[model samples]
Target: MPVKTENAEQLSRADREARGKDAQAVAPLESNAEFTPGPSRDPVGLLLEQEKTRVPELLPVRHGRMLVSPFTFYRGAALPMAADLATTPTSGLRVQLCGDAHLSNFGAFASPARRLVFDVNDFDETLPGPFEWDVKRLAASLAVAGRENGFTAKARRKIILAGAESYRTAMRAFAEQPFLAVWYAHLDVEDAIAQFRSQMKKKRVKATEKMVAKAHTEDSTKALRKLTTQANGQRRIISDPPLIEPVEQLFPDVRVDAIYKLLREVLGKYQRTLQSDRKHLLEQFTLVQVARKVVGVGSVGTRCWIALMDAGDGTEPLFLQPKEAQASALAAYCGRSPYASHGERVVAGQLLMQAESDIFLGWTHVTGPDGVDRDYYVRQLKDWKFSFPIEQMIPSGMAAYAQMCGWSLARAHARSGDRITLASYLGGSDQFAQAIADFAETYADQNDRDYAAFQAAAKDGRVQTTTDI
Candidate 1:
């Protein structure tokens, strides 16, 4: 089927509803075909190919992290999964997709309003794609995670269904609201806690409150205290080796002065991407140190650097992370991003899909020491951000968390997609939810197979890994 590119504003709400109903003729709501690896394609090869675009030395660390579990491998295998999702059935409605919208990708972060808000926190793989693609990926993640956690199949199915249902119901609610209202709708931490308290037992609610309190303390000041130290009357980033090492330590042959100059130039360019007020706020701090920090499974091999800055009086500290951005995993299937710079692409997508964003979010392009031009987006190192403890998740708790993830994702799509049409397509039924449940189960099986293949490759010396990066 040809992709649907019609703008939501081109049709009346009723007309959009009719258009959505037309979609069922192409693909039924409950039809979930199993994932079969393409006859000529190799999942392992696809993974190894992505490594070519990353810092070569860190590739082993990336593999090591992914080797931990099938769930972690899933996190790093967005490209392989995107290739498969392109072959699956879609609802034909596009959105600013969190292209790797797994359960862990949704988390709590402090918004510009200084309120802790819950939403999709990662955007490295973000792009425009069918809304169902995100929903399916999220559902499948829950299934994989449930298996890893040893939940019964029946219990996993319930969680998937609950998540799908939450998305459908939330989309329906957003569809009824005015466009501006839908654009502004957000779930702050306090609001999240209240909703959970009403539905959750006392024990879970207390645990949640404690988690929220901890997240609040994870701001820039806290990070500064933990990751920096005074060296010759200057605060410098403490090298923890492999995980958090100074750039000079990793690249001893390279001139440190040249790297610092290039970074300063890149930071200046990035400042122009921000709003006038944010740019002014940033000017108060001067850069003191920069360190390459390996972060996340999928992003482990990427050149992620943390820069520390301080006010002239040494009273205020600011931490900014300038992480490399590459072509989104979705770009190959959907289309090249409209923005020239991939960093700009990431920043633009985040601003569009998120109700509120980090005040310092911006992008820049730089030529690295390797002579390769790279794109990077910069933002505060930590702004009271934290994710829930998935290890402690019970079936019932997962069900609740899944619902929140679904609701959050739906709200994000509603802002950048046609919620009215999505609502009409879903149409107050369980068919779509059931379809997602089916897809989740099947995809979870596929993940297991892929993980086994990866493990075998590692054992045979086809892949390399270390205990810690």
Candidate 2:
């Protein structure tokens, strides 16, 4: 997958810096502060349009989750913001975007090397677009979350600025590094804790340590103990309705054996996409059973499944998640993805943006019984996964998290975009960061307005919430 500004790599360092300066000259840093939505914009209607692409029966669940709060609504409203971002000025610098770079999207997971690392963990709406778009998405998420947490206006501004400033400074630092150095760069969670350990109180450090310990306990073996039960002397996924429905329950008309056979075939196709080493590793296990699972506030309506596999010796259990990948929300404003399938688009974007990727990461195109084809990407489930407790964060804790997210985002963008040019456009001052902070506050206001309109629609029966399977 080629980036929009790949040609910049051929230019000399001086020339690349000049290109950034030229972009800054045309779109000044202060110009990014403006946020004027067109009069005809209909946020609720935009969401209604996206609803058409999701699983019809699960629509209410998505709506119910989004209606939980304004921040929740913002999570599912990525398309509307993509449209809003189209109206903002760009620096003309493009990168493989996370497209939905909210704070919750950044989390800790085990890298292929078995090291705990923090990076952007979601790429469902990834595509190539203006570098500012991703940064703004991240900054705005902070503002919205801060409001939900009851932070004061001044405190929220400080948190947002911390993220934006960290991004600018980090990009400048990366601009001075060699290509290989930048590509190999990563943020180890342990190292992060050590760096902050000195600055934090004893109780805070202990809490952080406890989180890391908990992550180590999350793996295939633990998942087997929690999500499966002995039935007919064979392991099977437990039925939990709406949230986690077993194959037998989801498709009563289809034979269980045939469903397992199809799952075997899907995994076979998916394995071909992995490297030779990983393909061989996957061959050691046999598929046990699968379950349909609803995950995340924004992804509730997607087709997601968890596959359980057992080693012949019956000791190691492996869990793999195959999730549907639709066309990116950013595709409408930025050009269509260069990849032939949305699955490949997600896998390619994840590989480009993350310092390290899961060994089993792969994509496949499957034809369902309804004669419709869909794209999906596969990865291990609950493998040392952990999310920051954003709702419980104090202002100082959030400020620290803001720095890590910002630094991580800059590193990701630097790998795909021209770092020298972006650094030049940002300059040495805090002007661009200040402008983004302003945009974040304004965008949070827009999110509230959209939430209010959505609530009204719910009253008129345009949307409803239910847990009935």
Candidate 3:
């Protein structure tokens, strides 16, 4: 799957550009305009297989969440789409992929500099793969979301074209720059607001600004206020049943003290993975309480824990989310990851793909309550993380958001893959964008059919779902 031109040292700039152009003859740009499911395709079966490694109780919760809508299903259906993408045409220009590069996966987060920067925020399924695979996933996500929002076909197509074209044009521009320039490029959230504010109505502009303001307040202090309560004079995470269960609730038979003791030891080891400065900073904070948390739809069944840490003074708090990392969905279709730990694989991919990353980003191995060894990556629970409520978004707003995602993705790909090669392959036209739009509509139709089949399976009890969770 990675049989593309990856070694820049072996090829001249002209030769790399020629290689990209020559790929068009092998797999024409327009060849991406169709979607045909293989006869053996069983979306439900694929989903079930993926859920096997997850916690049994949370399986129902995952299915229930995915059962919400086609768009919601698509959000948690990265594995199925990875299977589909493996069958698609490619130009063989490989890059570090946000293998689950759906619309909801792109957003703004606090950079190391404390500035809000937009980037591909989720990388649980990140791996090296054909660059267009991420592009198509992003485009198709917009189509799915548009349909859910009641956008007409013409509107959805226009949004998809805008996004795909943005990627092409951005890549072309990056191809002309020096390596450091491409590496340093980032979309500042404030700049993004400025760029799109004029295109929106006055009311919409105010709402957007309000959203940005809200993100700034979504840090550990906010989590401390919202998710914790005074329990026996200690600030402990509230037990919100399946959504947020204290570790004591999760393993009643096991001693809660013993679990915390082990976790503290694990964190002691995990801190070693960080830089000396970060490790020193972490030493100031002491692990306080931990809760088993249910996160995103696809990751619901995976082991996720919200760890509460206090800086001894008990005035300042730090919340970290330790999410279990499994083998990427692309690993089966592509080759197995070079890294021994899936957690490291995810962190490696994120560092390569994002212009700025969390300062506390690190990985560690943990033995679960069930006695199973699993890899996990840890990051701030929330640090000015930003996500849009696209349900209220209009078509023009979506078009603007799409361009931002496209440009950010291109920047990421340019840093890891060959910018010159991709620029040459995409050329100075919208032919590829048109093809992506065509494929988006076609694949979105397939997603609709699969979503319906999943609904039927749920009705027949082929899959159990507990929406109350």
Candidate 4:
């Protein structure tokens, strides 16, 4: 389970270059190849299998969300993509991957340093894999999303190619920097704005700024107002069945005192995983309420809970989300995680790839009344976070967004992989970019076919959906 690196430090730049060139023998460049569906491959069956581990009641909600469009379907279909990617060509260079590196997964969030930074925020499927796997997934997503945004097929190809080029150039830059400098590299909000301003229209710049302003308003205190209300002069989470409900309401059979006691024990264990200062800081808050909350399309069926805490002062609040962490979709294809719990696996991967992370980030195991053990990673909820709105995307806007994703992803890989080798393999040519563009186009077509199949399944009653909100 040791992380893969080529002992690349021993090689001179030229040697690394040669090694990169040698990779072409194993996997040729410029061949983005087609996907011929495997005779036994049933995408719907695969999705059904994934649902087995999810909360049974939420399965319909998950399916309903993914039914929105091909883009959303692509978002939730990471498992199938992982399977397909395993059959694709590789240069045999491995890195810690953001296994579901679709465009939507890149977003802006406040770092622990209190600076707004853009990075890959989702790590549910992260694992060690061929570096190209991430790039291909990203490229394909751009194509799918761009089509959804009404971009021409030709225009979408350009966006994918442009993103691949950005990744190649950014990786090369990181390869030349001092190791410590590369480790410290991060794209703060100002850096992000400046880059976008240089490459985008004024209108888009203003729009991005507006989005950033909106993100600043999302935090625990704000969440308290929206999701909680005073009960007997104390704050309690509001109950809205299906979407948000008290744990007691969801599990009516369980004693409320027992639920609180179990959570207190879990929180105590979670605190031990934090640094001393963070642990001390957490001691200031008192947990008051807990509720089950549904999250994103892909994450819908997972057991996610939000805790409301009083920050000692009556008016202030702290909210923490303990999201269930299952074994990564990439785990089976790559290898099992070395960490004892999937929660720990997620925490380790996030800390390694992000330049800055949640100060409260930690992991613990929780056993339900059924004697089932579930791993969860805890972090502050909605502490300044927002995603780019795909509805507003235009070809030019998409190109800029793609570049940002490419740059952010490269920085993540640089932190965990052999940078020099990766950059060298990318080379000083457009061959890689063109190849990825071709791959993106072909894979996007495959995604549409899968999405159609999904739609048909739902229509045929093979897939259930929940539309009631």
Candidate 5:
């Protein structure tokens, strides 16, 4: 389907009035509700189960040095927390939320028009859930990441508050804008840089420029060079044991071959999922190489395969990521999704949330050797995708960055949700902001304790981890 585009002027006066009224109504609910806690389960056991099922390789050891860090452990434990969070009370406001809205998840990528743009890139944990879940997760992640970056506690708190305030402020602004104006909103790099230029000091602008330049360094060729290495003159994914596991690991039971074959079959299915025009465009491409590439802290062990396909020329290639689709954590609380296939759910959600998406977005089911069907969602692995290094940002820069994330996230939610109801719930006041800020501080504390507990567990031989990547 062609991307939906709305001009600023398309937003009618009546639409603006409706949004303002809606925001006025929903503001009261923010103070009325309390955060419901997740189930009182053994967090360690839950982490282990998720690790075993999705990414067992991350559980191994290398060189007698286990790859178990508090951070890595926290990444693996989202499933249990998701389950627990589901049972809690919510504002009854739902959106197509990023199931895992960590700070690291926001990034930059090239649009289909070849224009560089920034937005949320990771959607692995995506599902329909309470909007506040995403906001809290993002705010807490900002705190954790800021702490890791050597920022002062006050700086970290300020960053989190800035992020929350941005969301609240942006939502109110969006609530006041006409529907079409809200729909048309987006942040291009030039515009983003300009916004930063106005808000930040000269030194900070230089720093942000440097960061943007660094992100630009990792284009398609750079991605290919990093992902593929020379193996007898044939470019292939480097098979570094523990880190880059070859298909051989999943073989012997012939599961590796099965997965490869299934991938080809699924690619064909994915093609069918596209509109005919896109399928024709894709047909011009030829498959070159396929490899199992472990990626990210949370997705370290999930079945992630990358296919390098050549377009018109051998040098021009597109990378496709067919990631394993596990059941969504939001499913329990949000109730059953109407989507019969998990892949469909992901594809549909992506289409709804993203302003523009890869032409290859689709899904398929692959039956494993155990006769169990695993759902898979396919998309461009990295088509000019980029993210700022959280560790590199200064306190003020981080705060500014958090605000951008909040604004982008609110826009995304507005696109896929009932704006009137959400605006009504959020209201014009900062009560929701204050509430989220309070929740974020508490959750950050909880996250630190959980992170510490995970480290203790690792040290005590209660859980296993592999750190080499």
Candidate 6:
């Protein structure tokens, strides 16, 4: 896809029209008339733009080689993939897309109602896009994951089919439900456990029970131990050389004291982004300690800080993550988003998609010593968030988990998009589902090729990777 000036102008007009149509269709639905799409930049150009903005200390020497393989390509190509999808055929129905809705992105978390729930957690690539894009990405991920887990080709196909079918069936059911009921529907941990027990019979259910039991027992101490290590006398993030460099190693130019001061200032601004009631509630929490943590394959080099705050006493520690924000991968292709602040855009999108969100959700702008404006959003890092490990899931278990993800994604979409119009567009057919399933299989192959290319590049010294611990 080329960055057509004409496409940019057309997108702006379409966005305004969409917002107007949305407002007229429903009063409660928020009108985003001012939300202009970014320039119609092609996928590779968008990826290059993102690569240019990455923290210099975090950049791999073989960044070019990393882009040569399909798998490495997938990781770095999120912005481009999103841009390409924007130009593809669609029903013209929009939703609160998870932007990067791969199988790994869906996870468990505690709901506002104090119940453990599982849903989509990562939203870095989130934006308003055709609803099917998320579904396709998710289904393709299931296929890739299934193959990695040693599932037969036929079995992988079943997984993809089941995943897509579940989404189609769930969306239709949700569309028929009353608005309030649909908005409030969510699967709590207990509900999930009950469902699992019924499906797996006594023996299998007992096995699953052990996993859940272990998960429930996981506390801050265990999480801290897993994510941190003892360095000299004080605890610090474990540095596994290039793959997991400590903050000090990555930013050698900045003193530790300066980092701490800047962090405190950033935290204060994050608190202010909360609603008055939430801010009042946050006042009771005191900062206990902070550590630099590296997480996720795609986000490895980005600045991610974890702060441990004491809520009441030593027993109750809240983990908050102040993650770095980049411009939406969809922004350039879609045209610059109307929102001035990317952090605000993320917060708004999360609030719109989630049934309830962390009370402390907010963002702030911080200029690093390097003179680059760094955008960040802060929220409770881990408040009873959990997920079934994809590698450990059996075919039946994977199917069940995929259905849950589909149901949740549909609910999120229905909440943000014009459901009536969307339902009408989908009608009573499986055509869309089949189309996406086919697309997912093809894309999964593309991803495998990309991953292989990345590995080969690394082996050939074209890409630099630190595999050994």
**lDDT for each of the candidates?**
0.87, 0.91, 0.91, 0.88, 0.69, 0.66
Candidate 6, 1-469: lDDT as tens digits: 1111223223443453454355335422212111123465444334335666655545563254344434335645566556546555555566777788777778777667766677778888777766767876787778777877788777777777677767767776775787798788776756776876666657767766676666565555666677665566554556665444555665778897787687678778888888898888877877655655656656656677778766764555667788887777766555564567777777777777777676668888888767788888787776666667787777877877787787778888877775555554444666555666666667667566556655665578655554322
Clashes of each: 0, 0, 0, 0, 7, 12
Residues 1-469, model 4: lDDT tens digits: 3365756777788887777778777777764444556777788888899888899999999999999999999999999998888778788888888889999998888987788998899988888888899999999999999888889888998899889999999999999998899889888876778867877888888888888898999998899999988888888899987899898898789899998999999999999999999999999999898999999889999999999887775577889999999988887788898888899888888888888888999999999877899999999888898898976888988898899899989989988888887887888898989989988888998999999999999999999997665
Tens digits of per-residue lDDT, candidate 3, 238-357, equal 888888999888889999789989899889877988999999999999999899999988888999999999996667999999899999999998778888999888888888889999
Candidate 3's displacement at residue 237, Å, is 0.8
Model 2 lDDT per residue over 1-469, tens place: 4586757778898999999999987789998888998999999898888878788878899888888899999999999999999999998888889999999999999998899999999999999999999999999999999999999999999999999999999999999999899999999999998987776778888898899999998899999999998888788888987889988899899988887888889899999999999999999989888899999988889899999998865568999999999988888899988899899999999999999998889999888766699999999998899999999887877888998999999999999999999999999999998999999999999999999999998889888766333
Which portions of model 3 miss their true places by more than 4 Å?
A: 1-5
Residue pairs with colliding backbones in model 2 are none
TM-score of 1: 0.97
Which model, 3 or 4, shows the larger TM-score?
A: 3
Q: Who is ahead in TM-score, 4 or 6? A: 4
Local error of candidate 3 at 461, Å? 0.4
Candidate 5 ranges with C-alpha deviation above 4 Å: 1-39, 60-74, 87-89, 201-203, 230-233, 248-262
Which window of ten consecutive residues has the lowest lDDT sum in model 6?
A: 27-36
Give the alpha carbon lDDT tens digit for every residue of 144-186 in model 5. 6776678887787788878877877777677667668887787
Off by over 4 Å in 2: 467-469
- Any runs in candidate 6 off by more than 4 Å, and if so which? 1-49, 56-77, 196-198, 201-203, 219-221, 225-257, 311-316
Clashes of 1: 0
Which of 1 and 6 is the better model by lDDT? 1
**Which model is ahead, 2 or 6, in terms of TM-score?**
2
Where does the lowest 10-residue lDDT sum fall in candidate 3?
1-10
Compared with the true structure, the alpha-carbon lDDT of candidate 3 equals 0.91
